[model samples]
Target chain A: MSDYMKRSFLVALWFVFLTFPLMVVKVNTLKNTVEWRWMNMLWVAIGAFVLSLLWRWALERRQLKNKEAESGEDESTRLGFGQRLLVEPKLYKPVLAVLFVATIAFPLLFDIYQTNIMVLALVFVVLGLGLNVTVGLAGLLDLGYVAFFAVGAYTYGILNSFWGIGFWTSLPIGGLMGALFGIALGFPILRLRGDYLAIVTLGFGSIAKIVIENWEEVTNGAKGIAGIPRPGFFGADMSITSATTYTYYLMILMVIFTIFITNRLKDSRIGRAWMALREDEIACVAMGVDMAKTKLGAYAFGAFWAGLVGVIFAARNTYINPNSFTFMESALVLSIVVMGGMGSIVGVIIAALVLILMPEYLRAFSEYRMLMFGAIMVLMMIFRPEGLIANVRRKYRGHKVMTEDVNA
Target chain B: MPEITNKLLEVKGLTMDFGGLRAVDTVSLDVCTGEIVALIGPNGAGKTTFFNCVTGIYKPTRGDVLVHPPAKKSQRINGFKSNRVTTIGMARTFQNIRLFQNMTVLENVMIGRHCRTTTSILGAILRGAKTMRQEQETVNRSYDLLEKVDLFKYADEFAKNLPYGAQRRLEIARAMATDPFLLLLDEPAAGMNPQETRALDELIVRVRDTEKIAILLIEHDMKLVMNISDRIYVMEYGKEIAQGGPMDIRNNPKVIEAYLGEEADA
Candidate 1:
């Protein structure tokens, strides 16, 4: 099926799923008060879902009709600036920019829930950027990057609880630990390339998880760490009780910092080195690039970011258990890089945001969403293996004056 | 004293063995300042094996490659260490053009300047003015190299996308980007037509004279070798059969026998 039709079908499935939870009879309240099921809640949810589906379907139909009408017109017509932007640009950047700006200004304009989702999106953004350095730039297949994320979380948890180290101090230390582990993981697998490398890295990740689980002396085993300290600035506690406003602002600051640094690294000499290595290691060595150092740099840098974000993740949630940093998490992050378009910073961000938020928007579809998502991935591979945002080097070009601007 | 120009690269008593078969046996040669030398021989004559030994791709079983960069003390180069070779003022192209398939044509050349790039962690983060200036200069230098080889038009094009002739020229341009004193070209005219080969001969001569870079090329084309080389070393069965100017070697009976027979030269 066409992407438009598939999207509608997904929306319909989401609508049915969203309303299913409302069928539950009675629910207990937090204050020990009796709470009765609200009648018509399912009906209302299903109605909303159907309405959303129709609205989305209508938009798609309208877009298709407009496309047909435009195609029937004369070919000699010149494209305007705004029209060119719409057709030519990858929708991710402008959309993300808008979302970013909105999230920053959200506390003033929107409610708390919107701000929370923004925080969630920001976390995935960091993870996606880190994965991009590994699976995208270095062309290393890492099916277990979240092991480093777990290391960061446990580092923060243990440091704050035992050593009295604040979140601020523990963050860098956590990143360093991640780097150490990353190097260790990278060294043994240096000789293994392609699929062999993937399997070994995956094995390393499982070993990390098993160690975390069994290391009851440090990790507290099945029961995860709780009451992890939040970040503080200028001796002012950044706890929820201190100020919700400051916490939201801090999240924004962190996301912006991640984006800026990732963008910088993506265009720098080191970034180019990574690309050279990915394209051909033999040629890269011939160009006088030290293979071991370059590969290690990717591992260390990627793990560092994941580690840093894990620190924030621990601080934000106030609780983190071993179960949270599973292979599924790594798979989700890897998929974001894959679906976005490998070796693209902007592409990963879009993938993270879309893939992360998809379940949230359609709560009911969360269960079967993965199945449909897998199907989409399969179809994408068959049709556009370049990912959702194809031709990262340049956008598609139509056979008109409109072609020049989009491609550029 | 003829200036007593220093030897940049010296290969002494080099031997490569494939099990019991000795490909290159005790072959020694010196490449001094500003000379175009050709290593010519019949197929399976160990010309390439000798080139590989000197370029640090293959460790000789019993010999040393001493590279002295214009008054610097000599240092031994180990095998399969390309970075060391590049650092010691040597750059070489493979018989099979090994350009990065996905990278841009400009990127391929810019990678040659990797050894010269000296940016700090902070510099990369801020992309300091110096870094920008250096990067621009590197780009400019790469463009100049490409222009020298007449491939400036395909600067942004992917390396693999170029036509075969352009790819060969690009390989030469990439080698030139390293600013090496010795540029090794392995079978550069291997698949070229007569017209292209003629252009390559002129290009090589121009590069030798104008760039002041010493070149050691391996070419099967006798016409190319005879016309361009200041000196040619003829090889047979892993040993240097004869080494002299093209005319002297051309008239040598040993070279004649290696090619046809002893009676042909007589």
Candidate 2:
């Protein structure tokens, strides 16, 4: 056999050996008998053999592409499919228009259940974009990002329970509260970076949850707050279906606002500073970018969106507990940002929809949902570590037409 | 020496100690307005360490760094944050070419304009009339700097995608975007071909002549240093061994020994 065939055979045999107990052997304790399924072992070997061949082919192709990249060939022509879809307005504008129409028509056509799920997904879309500012643009590994979401939720929950405040009033307040907490968290960990920053932020997230769980007087102490009112419509009460629709549209508007601001900021001076800070802090500082201000700005801006969405989440649920603001929620939102594309707004939206909707729609395969999610993540990392859509830097044109006396 | 009154940067008795090892030991240097000062030394001669001290990258254990802007008061600037140093009209390029690899060349230079431009987060999001004007001005100025360095054609290319020489020139353009009165270049010609080095020599002179920015560079390329520098300082074993004109340093026995090794007694 050739070397490739031999390697594939060895891989197949190794997988068969590794999976022998799980796949090939079954014990029936009730019948006091053991059953051996040798055919399952055959299936495992065939699957592993084909997969190994494909894996080797992919690795070889990746190596060849990397060599070409290092040779300084035309890089723009190598834009990924998702990036091309975004770069070409003719492609994206129609797609966006279709998407816009679909979203508007979704609640009318689908049941309240589907609209609710979409609202949840939109919440994550905002959260992912917010985290993109800190983790994607600023290059800060924030593990406790859910703490800001919790702060926003609790801001609305507590305000409504105590003072009988409404949702609209608490929306901006919740966002600002999140920003305030973000800056507070940002101050202590300014010197920490990478894994250390992640650890500290993770601790902060756990602390926020524990504080809410214990602080009975303010946060209801794990019994959770309930009966938080839905948003008001100019003093007119909205029916349950209309209210869900209202919140759905509100979330859509929020996503658009977030995208608008983020898109503008990406090419602005402050945004460039953050990207530079992400690339190299030492060089950024040398270039006259204030490290502390830029870092705090990222944290605050990111938290603001989380907080805004948190208020809506509380109003939609009409109840919230510490259980909702867990580390898994943070991880899910982070995965959306990573799987979509860090610093790419469009990527985050698509990722949020797929990640959120897939679980809901795949009820038949619910048992293997997490398994499939993990596998997809691993495969994505192996093949496209830059995420589903790599963020393309903004390009300036008309430089050739400018005269040398432009500065003069 | 025409009175040497326009002293742009002055470092006196600067020393930096990393744990038990003294990396830089009492190195004093000065650059006046309109002068290209070169800091030359053998490897591990504490030249970059001194630059770090002067640029506020390191808090010198014992020293004073002062800058006298042309129309501003003299201020002692030792131990200031590096960003603060740049804000005070001093910008620097890295020894290892620390350009933001993923950002476009124009964006990298625009970052150099960060301190000079004033735009709040709201302003950026809103893009008001004033903010838009400032942004246009920033882009124009950054592109102008790129053109000056002959990298205007690659304005939209990522900084990492540029050739090595172009990357070096991009660094200069980015630093110039800060509109600094004094520019500190850490080995600008370290890895350039002779032709690129010659181009760099011309660029340095043009920057000094046209922009009127004073330059303090640490370089190993002897030819470029000799051709462009108005004055040269030689360092050995973390100490200043010689300070004079290029011709004087070329003929100095102590400098020659430090670079070429000490001659045999015979």
Candidate 3:
């Protein structure tokens, strides 16, 4: 180990030990008796400092080794999966087949409880991708994205209850209604940028929730319209278990559809324009992109999926209330987009799966879940502020601009 | 497409006021078909402000600006939005290169083709034959523009990853993708070495000749301004000091004193 790093490690240890009295020590008062445990502080300081220092050392070592390896190697001859897929296009079919098989067998592989968790996670994957479009691709930093979710749920719920409309009929109307709300929300906020935009969006979400809570005549107020019909495909029994593997299958299909559209949009002109808008609004306008159209498109498209997924959420539970659509829901979707890295489509999916499922599995550790979330976020910001899975272009774009002239 | 006989751009008494100060003081200039016009001034001389007036970045406090696109009739274009200005065949590059930093080079150029193409959200979603063809053509045209600027090789690379000189060229390539009849370049040669400036000089001439587009550039680089420009409009303190050929402006004492010092013009 280098002497500088060793000294740094020692300094870290010394600083941690010095802070034990404040950071680790705890005092408790029980029935007028104040008990202090400085021994607990000493042990905690020693354990935590040692573990952290070791982690830092290992991380630095791996980074240093990676740098050396990269410096020594050339990519021209490397046959990684990306290159191999290019070399043999048929390789993708097998990969797709495997995924299809896995998705088909997922419910059977797990018990009803676990299957329910999988369905919920997949639903979030859809929601996360939808939010990803607004916050990730458009760089809009939306705080009120859940408003669209609620609108979709209510649209479906009201139509199903009053109009006797089936899921198939109301689906498009729900999405279109969600889209209209998205456009409505987007219109006023088009001129606002960054933090101001974020605040306004957060207000929009709160407004939607408050309206749902207080609008007793329409939404049944806090009681919420109960007995919302489940999605029925030609009278096939919709209820099998908690999620009803049928709804799970249908959700998987919806997720696939969302992926297809999102993927298509990402590589298209409108997608490029959205990216330009995110990167530099001035440049986007100068480049002749219709800012109004691009911004609205992002909001509508994002809200479409959110609305669709909201229908699924309402149907799956056969009930939804104002409590289901909350700020925390928006925050969870936004965090998935953030931790996945802004503009990373696949990263959002992975993050959505991990984030949604982690809490489910950690119900025993529910007390620590939020604390862990805060710690993870803080550490992420401190260490890899870029993201857990940075969009490839974003990762590559930060490479230092070349100075030497090409013609010279 | 050849440049027709009509003047491509005509700025008549364009004045821009910024809170009691006239940033651009009645700057009248004209660019004929296939001409290269240079708006030369030292820092704070309102050259960019003048460009902004014409390009719709700022609505001129007062004055009439006219644009005559080939096949289109001449029309007063004051107060048109920047995108509207672009659709009328006026595309511009920033003095500070504003290439979408996270986007690929090809994508950056492709964005410039946005106004030229016709694709709504439904078309984009469905990706029907017409939209597909338009997209493919846009890709092809962007590549062609990149090739003209000698940047086709770096098409897949992020715009921000390019060398400074390459980035400048990329900005020009992006602007050219708009298919503008009158291309406005804001200090295209800024930060460029002598060799790169010479290359840029050749590029301006080439773009004007091949594209048959009138070029207007605001530049501090006297050598480049003098070398490529058919006519130069010298401005100082928000007012035009001289408007003539390079040699004519070089000898104009007011132009010499206001901006181009004896050492600079030499």
Candidate 4:
């Protein structure tokens, strides 16, 4: 009787949480009239109740299926052909070939405006990949990653405006500036771990934002620099429409470079050291890994890509501003890394497109996107915490299959 | 200078204090190459504290720890970081095993080879000739060490998946990968059954004989210590109680009193 009462009470709480916003808030019309819509509360409450009941039912069914498997009712341990093919070594080349062709042919099929949207998606992909090095591989939680991006963008923006230097030279210079900032910021907070590290990096973003906003002599204050030059190719006229195509090609090349380099590092000695550092700090020290150096390596390498991406962002957008690199931008990049499996390269690419680009089509419910992200993250923590595409580093089965992220 | 070619470790008046309490007080010890020295004591007798001091986990409040690698002059390694201590040819295992639990058995051993090889970020991404050779050598040497500990069969399995006794052996194999001149084992036979303890006894002797390395171990298992150790040191209340040959220390009355009479006196 108590169990039933508890379940009913929880259902009521869920209904209240799901419907209260709909009940209390009034929408403003174009003519300046505000009215409460009470029916929305009823609809939302019913929806919440149905979803909760379905969730419980599904969980019970899954438990039953697992118990049956453990009892030896199911004997087959072999994977089906389709499953095997996905993991097979011989099929990898062909699958990659298809993806390669599709990436090149994709933007060409769409109009220029559509291609710009795809390029924006690609930019987020690079941002997501850069953050993955620290948060995913080395197990450092970095909340203010946009500071690195901002530093990269502002470096190129200032250099181009003052010295009249073009895109090609600023690319490396911007990356260097970004890496310097990554190392500088990482040094003070290197001793701090996890949530403390997150807070410190959050403070760093605000510091960088304030510095750019107040320093009127160089940064031009809040108004931001203007008339930055774009990229050109071999006597060809680089107009507004063609610049998008040029950047699209450059974006594809850069993503490929990041992927190839990251993959190689993942399997190297330094890669294993970073992972060992994450698994247990004491063990890492006892086994002869320099903690400071390895951690700084994660920071510098991760920031390098973010810096490079910032340069591309400046070149393609043709103008840059402080408003562009906000805390919300950092949150969006982090969401990509989390929604994708941490340390999984392919997962970041797919997640960036789904999370960033797909939101454009849902104009009616745009404000609810952050709310849905919050709910999805909560659900992911409870159900599939390793993420949608969990990257299994080594082909080893431990005592039991672990479901949590690297720490667990 | 002390003869560098014969001795593996030399500690003089090593002391460690935590605020008001002295955990290890002026404990002096030495281990020659190819010799097994056992440190046995009651719980909190500062045996592990002394190990931490020599292996660079904790800096000693006073005195020196010198490592005499083969053919190299004795170097005073006081206050060196733990990782650098491994590079200077000393490796240690914890009382509670500290294997990289998530890594494969092979990768755990490979990490021990960290100080022996060097690679840059450029070398890692390029897969050039020198980097390939370094990686291949790491793999081969790691596998060989795993074979020495008789854990080659479970190389691909995660370290955490190993059985309790196997996990202990895996820890030893990982420490040995640093190519240490002196290996420190903290309670190697703490939770083992008699049969497993016997295997560990033989394994320790084999490690000394085959690898030509000296070992300093802390063990409560009297049989394993007496059967394998060339010499023994006993500690009580942060002070050295006795030191001599294993049989001589075992028969000493003070040693017996420290073991059983402390509670009676209290």
Candidate 5:
């Protein structure tokens, strides 16, 4: 190898080494609290970093070589299927469906102990799909989306426990409450832009948690609301003694419903409005799309899905505390959207499952879990920043404003 | 088509102010039954702002825009608020092309039909017969529009992948899909080559003639504007300096000054 090449390899090796220490420091800090230690956590993190860096380096090197090759050769030929699938359509349904089905079915069919884990995964999927409408399609970043989820859960829990409402009846109320608050939250932040909007949303989510925690009369304070009854499908009540079967079917129903609604919205005029707004609000408005109405619609619809899921969560667990729906929960859901590929439904589903299930799979390395999660997210941001699907839809008819002179 | 009538659109004293920088100042214009009126201006001449104001994007600082439907159509717009201009009978394109990048070229046009489609949430969910028919018709109309734009082969393609000129054409098709009586095209010939511009001129003429739709076009292409327009309005620094037939606009000393600077008028 040439001198420059040797220097680059050493630099890559150095960067990989640096990441290991960072992981070690994080692992140590987390270990102080959780007391769950796996001997290989640090090694695995380091190995992943090295492998990722090497893969990236190899790709970069190949790209550079290709660039050189293309300088003397024709590069206009259409790419092969494998090239298209790997580079752009990595999150395409056919390629991703197997992993997604496995994720949904794994906890149900095989590991009963991890049923709660799947519940959480499915919850994030609902949340991601919810946020996807606002953030992915509409280009509205809501850091406080968890607030709506909390509202839905609490609304259902409080109504069911006090008013003796059934789980099914409470579902709508939860969705309504979520939509109401989503609208409520959206209105105040409508005029805000970018980071300012994000901050306000973050604050909104925190406020929801605080309200749930402090409102002892309604929510039972930090002790949280308990004995939140599970749903009875076809008048047959579900109990924990049944080992999560009823909830599984209910979750499947919800998953299908969320997917259906989201898909419909994605293809509809309203969906186009959202995308147009995302691309360029000024252009969208000029196209006769009512910006306020379209944005409000996204917020409302996203909240409804989140709220519905929240109700299911409360029902499935038969308990909920303010602690359960914290800012972290919101962050986790947002991360799923980001990791899955912001606008790809299948990507989001897989991302939610992988992130949710990874913790369970590494229960032995509990202390390093959050650290590893953070590392994966950071790595993803650096490398596969588009999330798993990354705006790779076959034909995007969404609005885009070309700033270049149209008269040119 | 029903008997075409007078006063398709009326804009009176439309103005826009972005923090005391008046973008469009007291710009009043009109498009009457099936006529092509051109808004010609230099760069930063506020033609787009005028378009935005008429489309209800910017609540005009001070203006009244009224649409008198083609007589046979009842006052279907009576109870509606005046500021919501497009719901009445107007549709517009941007100075820059804006097509939803993730959707198919066909789907992009369907979005323009939002105001007309009566498909309810239930209809959408169930794919009710009427809604399905409407959707099929919409798809067909989108195809027809693509074919007219000579972009039928690109119907299934993502709008983002289309070449620049094709994208501009797609935007026009999308705007037309709204079934508007009046179409506002902002800088429609901006990125087009001479051949494309010539074709666009012909297309614009055909659209006016065949569809019987009045067009208010904002174009910097002087040749195309002078060729296609029945009447022209020249504006500079947010104000209309000249308004008349192509010859009047071309010969006006003040219009020349606005474009070629003060020395030309002197």
Candidate 6:
């Protein structure tokens, strides 16, 4: 304990030294003077000291748990809080019921602005889950995932401007377009893996954005399409506020649908094949899983969700420029997947909410938001590398064979 | 002893070259139904390279890999993809134990059932009656295989958590889930203790007698190779040194010199 304290004190001093220039000395160019804030340095030292101690304690606890697991302790004891909740239906059933009611009543209780933000968060939930199929399940690092999102948005935007297609009709069309582009991208990079795949996908994302910007004839170049009509309720006329509420509900339903389908797919044969492909390509193929087919399926499936949500995004905003589908957007969605825990549905939803909604509400810390985000990400990497909830494989319970049967 | 029936796999004049160096040279081998054929050699003898050629991991420079399934016609599978080879009723395990480490033991086996089951993306999303039945069947079949390998208790455990010996058995169980006519074992007993090796010997014979599947193995354990193999093929420096039954192989002077060293004539 004394050694830990000494180490933490040294870390505190190091942080104080690191932040001294930025926090303590501020140059006032207009006044031709310098302001020294020694108090800020002291605060930094105190905060760092406490945080380092906590970090070490958490690391020690994690190591202890791992040792216990290695020694054949009950596996259930090692499950995270979220996993424990999920495992016990008695605990989760009521929690889920309350959550279902709260979501259904959310738009009615909250104002239009809040509902709008909720819609945005739900869109990201879908996007994170979609990318999870490729990156998490199939182990395909796709740095250009936003390209598919752009394709879906552009699909609806172009169709609406040219032929005046409605939201209902273009939804599936957008998803299909996204899947088509996914397959197109997947075909050329079938042999690439790891960092190579990431670089290629990053290029694909940049290429997509550039094409959208340059193609003036169809996309209107930088001048994005506007006035894309909201989804209709049997052609019922509704105000903007009501339309926003309608979108919120639609997104809720979409999130539910995505969760249901992805959950089912994670346990299916195709899903197992994708995971097997991710684990070891050679073994997967040796087990008779078609490599090309499984990989293309992951790409197409992941992109399909991105496309579906892209349409919703355009319709909800009623306008989209090339700026909306930038590389930062792709990185943001990827971060959500990473921080939420890859291949975990519940984790993604929670992470999407926290990430998307927190920034909106914490406008006071706007300037420091990115800095805090980077710090948290670094901490997460050091501690919980598996994200909030690590993915757990489905288990099967088979009837025990009788002792007589074995004898016979 | 069961008669060695029709040939299940026949590799003729298999030769593989990497750049200028020859890895496998004109190594012809065959396995008949209800037989356990062992390919024995010292390190760097290209036994693994030969397995890779036959399994389609490496397209041999000049060879013919022919397979005769139980009711299917004979087909040449040279240059085919590894997955295609597996789907055509030939499955192989890796020398280093390539079970899906992160997935459950049952899931590892279920992945092997990929070729036999047909469920499209739409089928998975919709999950109709047919899809559910197939999934249940896969689970049941995978569980049965785990039981056969005496790993049913660890069905839900991650593949990486299994002990060294059980992991080898799991590989065999996973390969069997592919329903192959011929199973290729690459150094299955490389790291096993004598008791574990004895169990593997029984497992191989049981798989042959009950499932009617032929096995081709590359092993370095002389006791295991001699005890279990119906016939043994010896290779030295990528060349076939000798081929005969276990008794004949035990007495062969060439195999002894290749394994140990040249005798000093006194």
lDDT of 6 by residue, B1-266 (tens): 54223888988999989999898899899899888999999999999999998988999999899988889898999999999999999999999999899899889999989999999989998999999898888888988999899999888888988899999999999999999999999999979999999999999999989998899999988888898899999999899999999999988989988977888222
Clashing pairs in 2: none
Per-model clash counts, in order, read 1, 0, 0, 0, 19, 0
Model 4 chain A poorest 10 in a row by lDDT: A396-405
Better of 2 and 4 by lDDT: 2
TM-score of each: 0.80, 0.96, 0.90, 0.90, 0.83, 0.96
Off by over 4 Å in 5: A1-5, A8-111, A233-241, A390-408, B1-5, B72-83, B262-266
Residue pairs with clashing backbones, model 6: none
Contacts from the true interface found in each model, as a fraction, amount to 0.48, 0.78, 0.68, 0.62, 0.18, 0.83
Q: What is the Cα root-mean-square deviation between model 6 and the actual structure? A: 2.4
Q: lDDT, candidate 5, residue B102?
A: 65
Task: Name the lDDT value of residue A243 in candidate 2.
Answer: 95
Task: Give the 10-residue window scoring lowest on summed lDDT in candidate 5 chain A.
Answer: A396-405
Backbone clashes counted, model 6: 0
Evaluate all candidate structures by whole-model CA lDDT and list the values in order. Answer: 0.78, 0.91, 0.84, 0.83, 0.77, 0.91
Model 4 is docked with a DockQ of 0.48
DockQ of each: 0.23, 0.73, 0.51, 0.48, 0.18, 0.74
| Per-residue error (Å), model 6, residue A184 | 0.8
Residue A83 lDDT in model 1?
31
After superposition, the stretches of candidate 3 with alpha carbons farther than 4 Å from their true spots are A1-39, A58-95, A382-386, A392-408, B1-5, B260-266
As for DockQ, the candidate ahead, 1 or 2, is 2
lDDT of 4 by residue, A1-408 (tens): 456445745785677776676674676777686676767766765666667766776667767756875685322333334334446779767888898898888767877887787788898899999999888888878888988888888888899889887788898988888888989988998788978998998898888888888999898879987877766576477767778887888898989888999889987888888878878777788888888888888888888888988888887787887888888888899988998878878778888988877777676889998888788777766555666666655543222222323556
lDDT of 2 at A261: 91
lDDT of 2 by residue, A1-408 (tens): 378789999999999999999998999999998899999999999999999998888988999988887786678657877898889998889988999899899999999999999999999999999999889998988888999999999999999999998888999999999999999999999888888999999999999999999999999989999999988889888899999999999999999999999888888888888999999999999989899999999999999989989999999999999999999898888899889888888888889999999999999999998898898789889888888889987776444445544875
Clashing pairs in 3: none
